[model samples]
Target chain A: MSEAESSTAAQAVAPVQVHYCEVCTFPLEYCEFGSSFKKCKESLQKEDPELYDKYYSDEALQAKLGTLSLEAQAKLEKEAAKKEAKAEAKADAALKKKLASQVTIKRIERNKRKHVTSVHGLEAFGVDLKKAAKQFAQKFATGASVTKNLQGQEEIIVQGDVSGEIVELIEEGVGVLKGIPIDNVVEVEDKPKKKGGD
Target chain B: MFKKFSPSTDISGQTSVKSSVQRSLRTNILSQWKVDPETFDQIWPKKEPITLVKCREHISIYQLHGEPLFFQHYDGPLFPTLRLVHKYPFILPKVGVDRGAIRFLLAGAHMMCPGLTSKGGYLPPADSGLPAGAAVAIFAEGKEHAVGLGVLKLSTEDIKKVNKDIGVETVHYLGDDLWAIQKL
Candidate 1:
């Protein structure tokens, strides 16, 4: 009885290590319900054939249908396939939109000699605006902040006119500025409006 | 509670927990869970401070090194994240649902009583029945890892007797938005 108690205690202390699928981030057994079931299955088959066989073998599939009827299983599979297609299409559309979006860097004239560079639309490429502002501040030793534009859209405004350097850094993919295409980056000059009745 | 969470908009702020609050929280977790001291220590070390992420509602998440370990609703019982439950499967009493309910559970629906009383499902026997409002790790039929975490809305015996309605209120599930945000 003491030996059995010790074994149980040991078991209680140890944590179980679970294997997760890379494609869907679910456990290996739950990949069937994930949207990327086919990709998960293929990846698992390539990584660990034995484990894949245990989950996907003919006998294993038969055993999994113990309580659920064949018709229910068929319906579930159909639903899973539909979900996969929908998710795939959604991801493709998002990617296309991101690629099509343009990043605008405007050099606004604060005075005759001073200007502030405002970068817009970097968030569309998955970059954190606050972090990018901090990076710009540190890289150029100037004050950079995220503020709303006339359209109420957030943009990073740097203290000095560093539009050329900003474009070069973005092209080089510095820090959090990765994945932004150089071709999509456009430079614009916003001259201060002439004072009325000057 | 985390079915439709998005970190960017939903989260309000994050602050490190005070030592006094951390002590009470540690004790609360020790009493509430079946985890051993050594295992708990490994999960949350003595020197490391936990971050409390306050969301839009009364929900607050406890994160360790950017990985969310647990969350709470108001002053309710702390529920472990599904990822944490997957690693330490024995922390909560386990209740499984049948194969047919797996898809619905993944879609963030509450677990019905029939799913628990079905042939493929399992509940603790009468001698060790759980009371209502107890946290449970939800497993799926023929699956080893937990698919969700929930709180029992009905006692184990009452569930078996009635065998209808929502038995478990799912707090977090496998493919919910909470599971998608691996790091904060």
Candidate 2:
């Protein structure tokens, strides 16, 4: 190797240099266990602007937070406020127009002698299945279960057709219980009572 | 090992849902699995609604296209009908075990960690660190077939620490109620 390269190599072989905080002289990494980085930055900026400026480099990726003029900054803040207000209003309107959501309840004729009432699409109203299922089973005096359908969607299944009373039950209980939206409830099946054939 | 399994109760009712209900159910399923909502309905396809019933002992009975498919527990994991496993095993998370462990797995005994930490069997990704109470499908080494569903009793780290018995509760074995649910 060249003489200069050999000298640099020897230097590289020597003990690794330890970096310390510019303001406190404490090691930077271990600062977290001590006063921390923010304190050091604040102290440097307050006590020694010249050192802080010397240490700061705009070219560094960390130092690249852009500075905006007062008017430009105000305009951006106003736009953000306006967008947030619009979103809040949109949510309020959606919540007010609860009847507009796509929710459907179906009554399935399970077999020859029995009826299975399935309440689907209630998730839109934020209905908790376990509680709802238990309530339905008690209300109708039939077994009820919260289960995922073929498509992995959660639905409440109650034994027998309480379809007519079920809708009213859900609507009335919506307020007392958590998360059953009154307006979002719709019955897709309203068929007349079937003959109790064995 | 088990001589018999908990049985499935036949659903007392019948259901024929609407075309719109079917459409929304498809959308709901796709959304739950986080598949693209915009994917064509024809690609996923629609089928006749299944016969469902509440199991007196378990959560409920599941039938797909009018055939009994799965029996899920209320507070615990599901006992999948082998017919369901026979069709779609890809969707399940899996654990591997050696040929020696396969016999115990079929007889419905819990899978110990010894097989998994040994020569033939291997672990799932260690970085994720399989947590307790998570369900996994057991697939035999070399056979490449899912034998059953299991619930981990302990965390993967704990399993690695102890080299002996009962790492996972065998929820649904190949020859258990899940395997026989299809015939009924």
Candidate 3:
């Protein structure tokens, strides 16, 4: 049989054991036990002792004790529902966190973009600045320099300061290096960088 | 001999790698420099761990006064391969010449491999008593041996011949120290 088909058959024929912890009935052995179920029972007991006592009575439990105690059974189902709800809540929280991180990161990146582009009328290429600078230096024969500051971040420092036409040439050079559309330039006050690239 | 020192910023004109970029630049030069393939193999051997950390950015030069002490107590050759990068120089503290990593040194030979950073997790103290800041890879085939990238004043052909005699490939250069692979 194929791998998928074999797996399905194996699963169908396999003896699945549900592990329930003796004290808490927590699902211990990889969800085989009922730790969560006991947790539910405890919560119910804490929330309303009178309801817990009524539901957890020996006689009532004995009636449905074929597979599980009535109280334990109720507890397991309640726990299952709570677990699904908890998982959904967690997923929602994670999504929100991810979006917030992205938004913050994008904002910082956008702010930095202004500086790289502003000085030389060149937009930030953002692709391994050192490599790009090396390539640019080779092509333009302008002896472009790549430096890394104390912080281990890389930057491409191209020569010649310009405003209108000179700025356009530099921008063109940058475009040649980055192979991307040049955005508008904005000034950046960056610390003098050191040199390094792998 | 009076200790020779230079300002770390002088890179364009300097031939000898400065103290700050010594360790990294040495490794890079050794890795990049011209060498025959067969000779490269004999001088420089390949293994899992890339012990040398590349620091081509900024180097800080210093004229150290005293010798660094290794964890082990042996007086052999002291090949100084000392240089620290810009701000991150203080990443690992130096007890003497040898900096401590994940594996805390128990004795000269025995080390507990905690395997913390995937570089085998532990390092025994260097047998060489010198305070050389060398990146050594200690492993066992039949017995234990150590290999690291070091800086030596040997030419390309000399390095190749050394590798041929040593029966390994490629010499890793760590500024001023030739970390020749050798059986301990």
Candidate 4:
């Protein structure tokens, strides 16, 4: 189609908002189409009649286009804003929750603290195995309950009210040896949920 | 004086030789790697063919100091050749290692290939180490060699953010249960 014809077709297709002029390709806001864009329309027709005829004028072409009504557009924008606000609020809530739940000590001191420990058997498997064990230990620590087996081996039962965070801490302890990465030392003992509701 | 009967013990020595041959055949047939029946037959044309059944019958538990000893599988003898820990050894989730944790990595290293060096991956400038949601650092013991295994704690959200930001599944928990900082 001719440039003018194409431009007209474009205008007919979507009348909502045009950023750039279909003909000149200059930004519509910069073009004469600012405030009351109707004047700009007249100016365009006067400036380039031949160009306008090729693209913009005539009812010969059927502009088969869909557009959101003002109400619909407004509703869409409102919904978008609501979604954004909800996301922001959720993020804020999460941050606040994190801050609130953090274990704060007036002073950081090293004191030997004792808790029930369940250390997994030594596994010669590679780092992946260690990581897997760490994850399992974390899961076991948080969600699962713990019991002592007849054989004296501590058994961690990942069950009701158990969480993933507790398991993570347990795994962290297991992965270290004098602050070095160690293999397969997941220990768990039944205790009250440390933080966060079960 | 030494035994003067050379011929008498000579035949016994031959029997001992036969026992050694039998042991050799047993080891070859009973070991993990199995040779083709045709090849076995060809190799032992003169001796009786030791089929899988015969091999099993000949197998004996080799013990050392009352302990059953098996061959130690070695990927390689050198520490450098040895592969680091697999995807997941212990069950930890969302665990990540930071530059500080990477005391194992060498100090002076240059970018060689993809993933090996931070030069190409989304490693942030040397000031604060790479930022969150950056690409995975695949260090191959370059200039900054990893001295030992370094551990880092990461949360599930952190992992998800990294994956989402990187536009790919870079870091994944090899195991269902993931170990994190909490337990550490």
**Against the true structure, whose DockQ is highest?**
1
Per residue, candidate 2 scores C-alpha lDDT tens digits across A81-171 of: 5655665678679787654665567877666556788888766666667787888888778999988988998888888888777778766
The parts of candidate 2 lying over 4 Å away from their true place are A1-198, B1-47, B77-80
In candidate 4 the C-alpha lDDT for residue A78 amounts to 67
What's the best-to-worst order under TM-score? 1, 2, 3, 4
The root-mean-square deviation over C-alpha atoms between each candidate and the true structure, in angstroms, is: 2.5, 25.3, 23.6, 31.5
TM-score of each: 0.93, 0.40, 0.21, 0.18
After superposing candidate 1 on the true structure, give the runs of residues whose Cα lies further than 4 Å from its correct spot: A1-12, A196-198
Task: Find the candidate with the highest lDDT and give its number.
Answer: 1
lDDT of 4 by residue, A83-151 (tens): 556656786786665434321101111223433333333222222334433454564554333445568
Worst 10 residues of 3 chain B by lDDT: B175-184
The lDDT of each candidate is 0.91, 0.59, 0.31, 0.29
Query: How do these models rank on lDDT, best leading?
Result: 1, 2, 3, 4
Interface RMSD of 3: 26.7
TM-score of chain B of each: 0.98, 0.73, 0.17, 0.16
Query: What lDDT does candidate 3 reach at residue B27?
Result: 53
CAPRI tier for the interface of model 3: incorrect
Q: How high is the DockQ of candidate 4? A: 0.01
